[model samples]
Target: MKEMCPNCKSNFAAKDINNINKNSIFIEKQCPSCNKWFCLNKTLTIIKIIGIFLLLITSLLNIFNIKSEYSPVFSSIGLVGILMAIIVTFFGKHETVK
Candidate 1:
């Protein structure tokens, strides 16, 4: 599971987990913006997965420049992906180190 830091609110990427111990269930990350360390909650992982999956679809479409009568459907999916990411960023529960 990945999460955002409450201090600077940057997403915790898998690459960021490097050099950190992962023997425990929880994931820890240092915020790139605020330079504070925080732990990722397990619950929001589902939302993160869905959001990234949808975002991949949108990203692929943009890369290929696909457009047609079905363009609106793809556009809507992209919008939904953005919304999901926003929700995960702002609403999903993440532990902020005190």
Candidate 2:
């Protein structure tokens, strides 16, 4: 997502970094050219989606060819986890500061 710097009117991408809250959150990045802080929430959501996908892949591998009798139950729970991740990552209020 592109946002125009309110200070200099220069456009730049927002960068996200870890915040104090345990929940996933958006943070603003300064414009590289103009040094103006702007929100990067949309960009951060994309990163969150990618991370979720990686988690899903790892969970699937763990569920494969397991000797445990509870493998099926574990796999089902993994599927549900993936679903929850998708919902939490994608089904939230967001705005792109154009």
Candidate 3:
């Protein structure tokens, strides 16, 4: 689906949204029509935050050499978080840059 610029209500091509850097949660995008800066909406921002936190926890488990039968579960959770963050980056709503 096309993304609409929150400021001007102009439609953005999916390719444009896909081209954005998904790795940086702090990145802001400028509306092509109005030039107003925007970022992901609060719900998406929170999801991204949680995803990062999960990934961090998983990484720490590896770094500290913590081993358990649930290690796979932790790794899977982290992978899910990363996937969610990436998916939301493209599909999430935009809000005025904070």
Candidate 4:
């Protein structure tokens, strides 16, 4: 499914949205049709940030050779977080630019 522009109320594919900066989530996007700026909703932004943080923590644990019985649990959580962040990128709701 495509995302709807909050301003023009027009539907757009994920590829149609342009990020102000490819590497930064803090930037807003412009609607191709309306030319109005928008951004991912606060809830999704938080989820994405948390997911990235979890992944970073797990990566650090591995890099430091921290081994424990809960290692598998941490790894799984990290995997889930990665997946969640990716999902939020495409499916997250958009709001006016923050």
lDDT of 3 by residue, 2-98 (tens): 7688888898775665324445655667666677777778788889888888888987886676886678888898899888888887778888764
Arrange candidates by lDDT, highest first: which order? 4, 3, 1, 2
Collision count for each candidate, in order: 0, 0, 0, 0
Q: Tens-digit lDDT track for model 2 on 1-98?
A: 44455556665453532222223355444556644444535655665565566567556666575556666665676666666556645454333244
Q: Candidate 1, residues 2-95: lDDT per residue as tens digits?
A: 5566777677675664445356545566666577766655666566667777878876776687765566787788779878867866666767
Q: Locate the minimum summed-lDDT window of 10 residues in model 1.
A: 17-26
Tell me which residue pairs clash in candidate 4.
none
Instruction: Indicate the residue-level lDDT of 82 in model 2.
Output: 65
Candidate 1's C-alpha runs over 4 A off are 1-26, 29-38, 65-67, 95-98
Cα-based lDDT for every prediction: 0.67, 0.53, 0.76, 0.82
* Candidate 3 clash figure, as a count: 0
| lDDT by residue for model 4 (17-73), tens | 774654665557788887888778878888999999999999788767787667887
Candidate 2 vs candidate 4: which has greater TM-score? 4
lDDT of model 1, residue 83: 83
Task: Please give the lDDT score for candidate 1.
Answer: 0.67
Candidates 1 and 3: which is better by lDDT?
Answer: 3
- Candidate 3 lands at a TM-score of 0.67
